[model samples]
Target: NAGVTQTPKFRILKIGQSMTLQCTQDMNHNYMYWYRQDPGMGLKLIYYSVGAGITDKGEVPNGYNVSRSTTEDFPLRLELAAPSQTSVYFCASGRQGAEAFFGQGTRLTVV
Candidate 1:
C-alpha cells in the first residue's frame, strides 16, 4: 500500500493563483504533516494534524491552510501563491515519536 501520496508532482503558478496540494496516506497513521524544503535549508513544518478533526499551525502557516477530517488524508491549501512559497513540499505520516514516511514530494514554483 502507498504510505503517502501527493498529487501533481510539479506545478507552476502565477503570482496570485491558488491551489490545493493533495496528500493521502494508506498506512492508517494517526499523525500527518506538511513540510517545505527550500534550497539548502532543512525541512520547515508548515502544518500538522494529530488526528481526524484536529489540526495545528506549524512554523510557517501564513498563506496556507490544512485540514484532517480523516486519518488517511491531510491536504494543504495555498492561497495567493507567492514566490516565497516556492519550494519542494513533502507530505509525511507516522505515529507519534516515530520515523515518518514521506511522499515523493510536490515541486511548486510561483512567479
Candidate 2:
C-alpha cells in the first residue's frame, strides 16, 4: 500500500497565490501531521488531526489550513502565499507511539 502520498512534488507560486498540497495514506494510521522544513532547520508542525472530523493548529499555522474528512486524507491549504512560506512540506502518519511514515515531500516556492 502507498504509505503516504503527496502530490505536485514541486510548485512555484506568485505572491498572494493559493494552492493545496494534497496528501493521503492507506496505512489507516490514527495520527497524522503536516510539517514544514526551512533550509538548515528542523521540521515545524503546521497542523495535525487525531481522526476524521477533528483537527488542531500547530506551531506555524498562520497561512495554512487543514481538514480531515476521512482517515486516509489530510490536505493542507495555503492562502495568499508568501516568501516566508516557501519550504519543503511533508505529510506523515503512524500509530500512536510508533514510527511515522513520510511522503516524498512537496517543495514549494513563492516569488
Candidate 3:
C-alpha cells in the first residue's frame, strides 16, 4: 500500500497567490494532520482531523485550511500565501498518539 504522496514536491508562489497541497494515504487511518517545518526547525502543527468530516485548527492555522472528506485524502489549502508561509509542508496520519507516517513533503516558497 502506498503510505502517502504529495504533489509538486517543490513550488514557488508569489505573494497573495493560492495553492493546495494534496496528500493521500492508503492506510485507512482515522487521524490526519498537517504540519509545517521551517528551515532547520521543528514541525508546527497547522491542522488536524480525527475522522472524515471532522476537523480542527492547530498551533499555526493562520492562512491555512484543511478538510478531510474521506479516509484516504486530506489536502491543505493556502490563501494569500506570504513569505512567512515559506516552509516544508508535511502531511501525516496515524491512530491518535501512535507514530504518524509522513508524506515526502511539499516545499513552498512565497516571494
Best model per lDDT:
2
Query: Between which residue pairs do clashes occur in model 1?
Result: none
Q: Given candidate 2, what's the lDDT at residue 40?
A: 97
Each model's lDDT: 0.94, 0.95, 0.93
Model 1 reaches what TM-score against the true structure? Answer: 0.97
> How many steric clashes between backbone atoms does each model show?
0, 0, 0
Candidate 2 stretches with Cα past 4 Å from truth are none
lDDT by residue for model 1 (15-91), tens: 99999999999998999999999999999999998899999999998899998988998999998999999999999
For residues 11-106, could you state the per-residue lDDT of candidate 2 as single tens digits?
A: 999999999999999999988999999999999999998889999999998999999999999999998999999999999998988999999999
Error of 1 at 48 (Å): 0.6
Worst 10 residues of 2 by lDDT: 92-101
For model 3, the run of ten residues with the poorest summed lDDT: 1-10
Residue-wise C-alpha lDDT for candidate 3, range 20-108, written one tens digit per residue: 99999899899999999998999999999999999999999989988899998999999899999999999999987688999999999
